[model samples]
Target chain A: MDTILFLFSLFVLALFLGVELITKVPPTLHTPLMAGANAISGITIVGAILAAGADTSSTLVHALGFIAVTMATLNVVGGYLVTNRMLAMFKRKS
Target chain B: MNITIVNLAYLLAAVLFILGIKGLTRPKTAVRGNMLSATGMLIAVVVTLLDRSILTYDFIVAGLVVGGVIGAVMALKVKMTAMPQMVALLNGSGGGASLGLAAASYLQSLERADFGTGAIAVLAVFFVAVTVIIGAVTLTGSLVAFAKLQEIIPGKPLGFAGMRYLNGVLFLASLAGLAMLIANPGNTPLFWLTVAVAAVLGLTLVLPIGGADMPVVIALLNSYSGIAAAAAGFIMGNTVLIIAGSLVGTSGLILTKIMCVAMNRSLTNVLFGVMGEVG
Candidate 1:
């Protein structure tokens, strides 16, 4: 329980700090920063995957975990790719 | 099982969840919303761990240690440029966790001698299976949105000729899978196939959405995650989880609305809207 609490608080803190940073930082960096945070969220994905294999129930847990894994993976892929693409716009215009 | 204390805990958590969502309505008070929601989650987790059969101490300690360390590191080390990606990933994980819990609860039910042998039991299994499919698809789809935002791959929208037709087919297939599961939930293969189809549908749904509209996608996905959690809570008969998850689900939907305003776009513009305009 404490662990989940901690994780939850951590997420809140990240968002709090995120809003603050976005305000202070220039607009050019917005996409990249968001992408990075999205990647970190993958930790939860890992935890979920592990939980799937935990001692509770196998079939349901495994299935759920598989779904979570799939979702998190897509998030990582899509977020990073988009951030990079946005950053690419900063290249010197001819 | 005396449930007075647990019920009260859930009631309190639900109140906090409501407060948190109210707070999240505006940027100025968003932090308060986050704090309130976090508090609600804390209450929920503690109450869940209080179950007599949980064997709490060791696992609880380990969970805190590992989760705390990673969370701390993430909070301190990650730069702002990566915040959105992080949000996407974290949101994806939350969705996944909810899905996993639902699945675990179902599996436990199936293993029970009383439940593994009847038509009613099959209905229960079907609910669990359908929940898993929706939850899984939501999870994967959110991740894909995250990836598009971060530019790990092309951020350009990917669409095929007859894309709408394809999506339509997938939707129908998902529904069929649901019907099949409900009719014969004991068939594990059928359940698995449903999950697989749902996942592919998730992938398909997000594929054509361009990078520019990802914030909206993220918000929408957050709502989906919350709904999944709520379903899990129902399956497990966990009052706290249900309340907290519903709070998140509703709040996410509201947030998505605000985000659309910020972008000067409508929800329709966000989904099918982005496709009409090319990079």
Candidate 2:
């Protein structure tokens, strides 16, 4: 538990700093940053599905697990779509 | 019979999750992924309901209905610009649920001595307690992040030159506290203290992270919540929980790496870049 939380917190800090540093760099990297973050959110879909199988005794647990999975799927799907759309806006002329 | 049905549902759900991930890779198939994942979830719910031992199904049903209604309303109403805030809220809710479950299990164990003070039982309880604290911190800190992103709170990073050093010290302290708790089980005060400190650390650490960096933070917190849930599963000896937790942990880390590359930043730069000012 401690290991997971500590790693997660560390990741959050990494993200924070990454965003902070980007301002000093060129704007060309924004699309990539967004894409990367989108993938991170996608991980939740896997987690939700896994949680679905964790408990076999509670009806509520099963129901909640499914709900989480669905919600995460939406986030992942919508997130990627939005990222793609944003990238499209940045297309450069040949 | 119930176990068989539940396991089957889990199997179906796992397949759906895989399909959903595949669908999510491209814009054209994103909707399909959403549908597949939702279907998997539905299967899970139905199978769980087949279980005969759930004494509180009635209340659970009522709670489900209420939650469903509220969730639908939010889905229909939230603006795209506010999506990150919504994500933050959802992540916080997930963390809260994990914390609540861990606490409930701990209390249940204390009252019933269900496992009779065995070494495994003690380990289970400790894992649950630690998970609960970590989850609580994630929940509260994520909510605060949402507020900051929404401008309900300040978006600026907050700290001094030595603040990062202070955070490091606090982390070590939390680690020591956790070690002590493990050394002596049933230390409720120590458990709560560990939780309080961790929670503060989560907020302080996050507060300095700018809104521009929220996307990755959200992903990382989502991973934390998954882990907390996994630990709860450990206490209950739930196989699904462990699988799900590991999946998130791995994926979230991968995503974090991708984000670092996208920003042309190193992980160390991000972790220690808590400079006092931002434009």
- What is the C-alpha lDDT profile of model 2 across B213-263, one tens digit per residue? 766666667657666755665665544444445444544555555666665
User: In Å, what is the interface RMSD of model 1?
Assistant: 10.2
Reported per model, the fraction of native interface contacts reproduced equals: 0.12, 0.00
Alpha-carbon runs more than 4 Å astray in model 1: A1-94, B55-68, B113-123, B269-276
Q: What is model 1's DockQ versus the real complex? A: 0.10
Per residue, candidate 1 scores C-alpha lDDT tens digits across B1-279 of: 246886787677666655654543434444454466456655655664455545324433444455445444554455656666566666666666555555555555555534444655554565476557767777688788778877886778887756767777877887887787666655667766777787777777777777777777776776666556555644544544444454455545555665666667678645442353333
lDDT of each: 0.55, 0.55
Interface RMSD for candidates 1 onward, in order: 10.2, 8.8
